[model samples]
Target: MDDTSNQEAYDRIARIAQEVFDMPVVLITFMDGHRQWFKSHLGTDRRENTPDQSFCRVPIATGKTTVVENALGDDRFCGLNDVVDGPGLRFYAGAPLMTHDGFAVGTLCLFDIKQRSFAPEQVRMLEDLAALVMIQVKSDRDIGRVDPLTRLPNRIQFLLSLQDMVRADPGRTCWIVLVDVIDNRNANDVIGALGIDFYNEQVRHAATILKRHLPGNTVYHVGGAYLAFMLDGAQDTPHALIEQLDTDLREPLVTSRGIPSALNPCFGIRSAGLMEMSSPDVLRTVLSAAREARLSERLFATYNSDHDDAQKRMYSLLSDLPEALRSQKQLYLVYQPRIDVASRRCIAAEALLRWNHPIWGPVSPAELFPLVDKTGLIHEVTDWVMRNVLRQIAAWKAAGIDLTVSFNISSKNLFEDDLVSRLSEVLDATGVDPKRLEIEVVEDMNLDNSHIAFSRLSAIRDLGITVAIDDFGSGYSNLAYLLSLPATTLKIDRSLVAQALTDHNAAVTVPTVIKLGHDLGYHMVAEGVELPETFEQLRQWGCDEVQGYLFGRPMEPKAFESWLAASNKALLASA
Candidate 1:
């Protein structure tokens, strides 16, 4: 298992057998300790499996998974009639290529003479692409066991399906229910941008309601938001199949965003017995009794085998976040400064996202921005944060820092109908000033899909940029859908500026949403100004700007160029 982890698990099983069987042909041989060695091939036999007639010895004598429909009535390939009657070979399917311990040794199996009949979702996408090539050959042999997101089966497939159900019921008592999902990234940022295809269709609808209400031989998703099941030792059948998959993945899926979001799970039940331990210590004591039933549902966190393994090192740092955004690695950016309350200076900055975690330190945009918008990797992390915030506003206008930076952009980056011609080709490839670049967005759109969020904020205000609407009154029909948005700016929401001076109806709903965003000409800013009476009551309510941490905290381009040169000497010593 080492020749660079068997050539990186034979190049991820010859690239998922030529992308899940669109198969021009793929091979992975390896019976090698004796003869068969081809390790990866596609489309045609450049010949190599010989030592004693080996078409993988019928997937090691059908220990399970071998189909070759019509290799001419398959009489052990009727004496290999010149390789299946003169190159005819006829439709085929084969599975038994297992290794992570229960070794069949080789055969991902597929070849077609074109007779056809493949869909049961293409044989469960070729048995989940041969269970992702036996989870990259048990993670290149270190065997963390599995669950690098739905490759399914983990906590070592619930301790090898609880040691084959305690070596086939040595006594009885089994139950080990565990469930997950809650605060699923702030209910997927309040249901906008189709909350990651409704959080992967509520984790494949909670693994199809625990494989249709659990009489399970073993079910396990086991990564971040856990899902384990073993139950079928009967007796009131594991609390009625964990109360029917906690009422079918907490129900509410209807979308076009009226905000119904469901799935809030956190279960933990344990029972074991057949002489107390081992089955990975009773699946780590039903994952420490589902981490004490997730501390009474305070948003999941349970594990045992003594905690340290921070969810298996956050599933090996969410599995190399796709080679850290395809090798741009731990991507970077951090600005924040925003001020301007009638020129208190640091005129604009927000860009903020930071990961730099080559080893887990700074990750937040609330933890890799919904895992980069649930793995679509937010359009290549918003095209590397809009080509590095237009090359840091063309490096803050060659050190001038005239200011206007902004950035946030994610109502799914305005459904990309060439997002304003790819933001006018990254502001004509970084000359930068699309009026100093502001963008923001995030009130989490789908305000009843307000005409596809006002045609994606009118094609991002026709790319001149400066859009805004971020968190404005934390959405749910944002002020009866603010004039169908062409958004010039209207930030307003750090939960209505930390409840405007102790909430006198949030200081009359923050100056009536800043006089209805200044009678709709719209420019109201007031974000989270910590206090100097909330930046002089958002500059006596006219509110044109005011960012947070009381105007400073998200620094770092050399501490925001030395906090914009000590905020231009405290704005010329307070004028």
Candidate 2:
């Protein structure tokens, strides 16, 4: 009713009122700011009226129906100039069009040429029509404000509520808790196992759970497998309830198919006190925090100052990563030297990624490399790594500090047919010997299309770049597929190497694996050689190469260059 001017609808209602009240005139007019506009009328064709000339204004102001059975006789209504003379309207009975909050915004009234009295039944009918009018107003306004799926107030309505909350208690804080299911990507698995209908049921179940747990909480399905609700006021402590929801939500949901689907719910709580941002901005920041928390391995996390700093860092890195890959700005490679078990000399070093963020200082590969997978920029990152590694090798040869570096490649990169050509272009452009480079792939990497991956790997091998199956045994791999892979080297995972130190079965498994590699004519590299026992056992097992802290840690380019010059086993660096 704030901006509504539906004359046709009001005309229909006025027609009904004319018949219902049996009055000479029936008009439905809404208070429009300081003036009153006639939505419909039976006796008059006029559209608008001034507030003083408005009979509807009295009912709107008083928030109750005005039964002016004798308008000229009533002292309160006699002030109107129209009532005294013009049209000489003496009878009036107006009903207030009230909103949900009890604010009367307009009137539905009846008038007659002569003074008249109405029965109680006619008054009740007038009130009922007014109620219908309010419903129409509210329904029209709520069209876009309500969610279609859950039949709840949507994001827009939530923001409106937030604004109301803020304006009502400017000094108080409001908290928004977001619940997200992380396994929606795997929701397809459930769909395949059961049916797509079950997925819809899961959402209903989640919504029901939220409503049941937090009775008055307004739950919102705010896009992308996320549900949110807000809590206000100081007395309402939500942290304990949030914790309980986190724990209770861990239970697997039984779908309509009677099959249980695991739910990984991550909760992020954001609070604001002493208003710093508008409702929309607050909602955006809160949901952004929820997304970051969902990204973490944690089940639940609250947005805080530290998370703010970390989120800034993460987005900054993500935003800059593409350009960093293309331009190689503030990015470089470090190598961890590997030792030969029999020759007791350096064989090669693993090329590791390092980033020196202009603002955040040195960022570790342990912290940075995962950004590639998350952004789906693994191909770009891999190309950048290889191009730089090859270029660095050529530069090292010129400096008389020759080294053969093994660079890691993501499965996505290995699967791409363009990868082999990309590496060939880098090798040819840099004029670096291809034999001096090795590309390593993790055994755990998804190889559903093994033939295509191996085809590309074999092509790279044919170009003289040896391939190593890295992190062997850390993740399960098919032995038959492993044997068929076009890899010449196998790097036993650090975990397996660590386990060999204590477990007898692991001790026995290590030698058998080494013997199998030897029989297959593949060189075996034992990583995580931290202790004397592990070192001696690996040496006895005839492991071709050993890489761990026992030899040398991953070092900066300059440090490794200097180490290459000083080490007696310079076979890897001065080849």
Candidate 3:
């Protein structure tokens, strides 16, 4: 029979063994080079092996099968039988794997205890399984090393080729470029439970594109979000390679449904001749540099001693983030006011995040947001915010204030299959009317167009709570995306409003946003109207609400309540 039919023989063997001995572990191994490697294992540990120094070596060497009922007392195996006498092993059986050329490679085998006699059915099964293993090994030997992800030749193949090149010219120089995706945790959070799968696909897609553009090279997944490329000769410079990789990877990979998502790539390049480094060192240094480049929030960075300090600090921060959120170290919240535009009355408040660093006093949201996002602490932080906000809102209710409070949500929270349900549970536990609560989602929720987020947001709104698009204009203009979202309010981003009074672009943006929002039948709120002029501009533009320092700075709950009570008394006295 041709080698391909061995698979059929193997399956037959496995079935026979299972039917006869009722044993789970069955494997076919072929003797190749220094090892007796497995072609397949059925109901057994895949690729599990006995070293060449052990008893199985004799059978493959002698082109025969071996069966020992109990190795401890069997003279042929007693000299080196500690493995079987070891825990969880007793009876042993093996059959030599035979090649089509009639060479004995290794064996088909079964393992068990209880000292049972072998059955004829199991013997024939083992023999067939052994033949199958041989067929698979022969097929594999013909194929060059290919990565399971992109089907590109892997690092092993590249190394072998590089060795050949080295023999041709002992002084050959090679450059290795390492590309990595930044903020996988954020990606996962944004993508929800299927985040890892999405991320892996993105990597493969990017690798495929890069492979087409690259010349005679292999890419390998050295670790999470990292791919290494080895370039031989001087056809491409490190900068050019980085530029090409950056372009290739930066292109958005839209889902089949046409939802666009961006993946940021950080590239690090190390060429030979600088430090006289080995190929492994070149790869390692480039990876380290790529990580440093990501940490610096740069496109890329070359390896340097100074970068090590930053990388160490970044990793230290990441490692401690979970503990920090769990403990009292760095997590907290700040409340900002949302005002009614017509009356300039503060009706609701948005919760902003604050990290009270032990030494730094306050870490900016720009830094801490990404840090928390990186550490998967967004949900933890958001949960704390919700519970704390509910308690504060409850206190405010008792104090005669019927004000609503909104908290910003990560996209992770928006698409969480249980998000609305969990929020319902929290409200049940807290007895806070979901009506008085508001939720603000980032304008770019990027739910991959999953109706899950829209449905979840709709559910929250159905609970009579308010929903708003926070940080509008911070993301690209996806008008259809905005219309498709289930938010009741649009909050103009601070960057847009910060320039409203002076910049013509900002002035046009405000009126246009208000007009578009009005046309959509949604309320509009302008954030960061620090100057009174900016506030008046939003009101004049017909924005329904405005929030910023012009009305009042974000205050502690106690201070905000005191301010509310004072305002109430002043209004009453005026009446």
Candidate 4:
């Protein structure tokens, strides 16, 4: 009834009826309980009337053509306002709009001020017109509910069904499950390698498997590679179904094109009372759980509100991060002093990113960077840090403080073709000496693209910037691979530093790594040194720099400057 196409089609039929039967008025209407709603009205200004006063209601009730040759002569409708006072008198003819399931919901009708007889032939033609209207209605409904590819109910239909179920039994519990046949990345890879046809075949194959497993259940094609279905919480065991699917999906899927493909299917399930959540929210919650399963490499994951809430907060941070970078508000940098081991002087600091979210209070870099690494925004984040750090260096230079500041970047940034050039541009713009800036690359980065990473680091070194291998001993540590890089500094990982104080093997290995780095002509820095004894041990082992809470926690620029001044004074007095 809300569809304009339906109204336009009904209007066309109404006009045709008015011209054919030579009636003064024609109407297409639906019996809506208390009133008859006019979908199309011609040759008259009336929009609606009470069901008792409508000629269409009789056809809707009888499921056949209804006619009143003269309402003034008919005892039933003679007292109606249209016959008694409004239109004076009326001749009515209407045909019931019967659905395929044999239910009459509305009618197509004609009216005249003069008494006239509706011939049997004319009544049959009106019924055919009503059938045409039903045809359009059925097509519109199907187009909205059915998925073009899978021929199953679409997401819209799924939501509607869920709503209907909730309305019928608000307190009933149900399990909603989403199956991800393959991740987007692998799906794109397949599309690029073979074609969309092959990819679509895989989706269809997945749908077939789902339907075969859960007979009599409506499966929805919710996404490109996602199929979802709901099960009665009391009747069906979701875990048993999950286990069966896990075993079945482990087998390789061979497409019609004879290409064998491995399917890494993950399931996300949520069981909730119908009244507890809305349909859309249920889908979202299950989707989040499914994503978590894929990320954690699990066969299935049930919805956990804590995990879901954290995921939501993570997404919120990612969305807000770009604006924070642009405004420089909320996002700022703190520097942790890296002390010269022998001289006891602050020679450099590591610039770490911090976010004081207006609502979330403070977001940890530990939580932020992992999420950022998965998106293209990593480049924007890296660029923001680089530009801001350079500007801070220039500001410190203007204040007569010369300190080398280093910042970290993700492994993905190493493959960016323009990374060095962008850094060069920012360096030139800030007018800070390249010698004062350092780039710290993580040690455990995926080395599958080592050539590109090494080349990028080499270019940075050639540009007069220091390159440091960060988190050393935390990842695969190969001496030959380390020697092949152009980096001039190696920062011992905090985990190794912390263990060196307690573990016998770590204590022996820490000094060995420091000696190895020094022998290779690379400056060695020990991280997470929170004790005087750890500092003295590193100093004795010829570690060039030490950075940890023992020296000072990460601080704002002004606080760092004050701490540096006080530290230098203490060093001068001790000397």
What is each predicted model's overall lDDT from 0 to 1? 0.68, 0.78, 0.71, 0.87
Pairwise lDDT winner, candidates 1 and 4: 4
> Arrange candidates by TM-score, highest first: which order?
4, 2, 3, 1
Assess every candidate by TM-score.
Answer: 0.29, 0.65, 0.57, 0.77
Model 1 TM-score relative to the real fold: 0.29
Q: What does the lDDT read for residue 571 in candidate 3?
A: 61
Give a tens-digit lDDT track for model 2, residues 1-575: 54454446667877888877777788777887887976676888777789887777778889888888788788777878778778877889999988888888788888887778888888889999988787777776676677666676777777777787767777877777878854666777777976667766666677777888989778887755677887774656577887777666666877766777666777777777756335366665666666676677666667776767676677778788777766646888888998888877776889888888777788777667766665677877887788888888888889986667998888778667678788888888999999999999876536755677878889999999999988887867557645688889989889889989788878888888889988887899998888888899898888889999977888978898777667765665666
User: Considering summed lDDT, which 10 consecutive residues are worst modelled in model 2?
Assistant: 1-10
lDDT (Cα, tens digit) per residue for candidate 4, span 168-203: 888888888999888775787789999999887877
Clashing pairs in 4: none
Model 1 off-target regions past 4 Å?
1-176, 179-229, 240-381, 384-406, 409-435, 439-491, 494-505, 508-540, 545-575
Better of 1 and 2 by TM-score: 2
Give the poorly placed runs of model 2, Cα more than 4 Å off.
Answer: 1-160, 181-185, 191-197, 208-217, 236-271, 276-312, 326-329, 398-402, 448-452, 475-481, 498-506, 530-536, 556-558, 568-575
Clashing residue pair totals per candidate (backbone < 3 A): 4, 1, 2, 0
Off by over 4 Å in 4: 1-149, 182-200, 251-253, 259-264, 291-299, 326-328, 414-422, 443-447, 450-463, 476-486, 515-521
Best by TM-score: 4
Please, what are the lDDT tens digits per residue for candidate 3 over residues 327-399?
A: 7657766677778876656788887767666654676677657666544677777788888888778877887
What is the alpha-carbon lDDT of model 4 when measured against the actual structure? 0.87
Candidate 1 structure quality by residue, lDDT tens digits, 160-180: 666766787677775566676
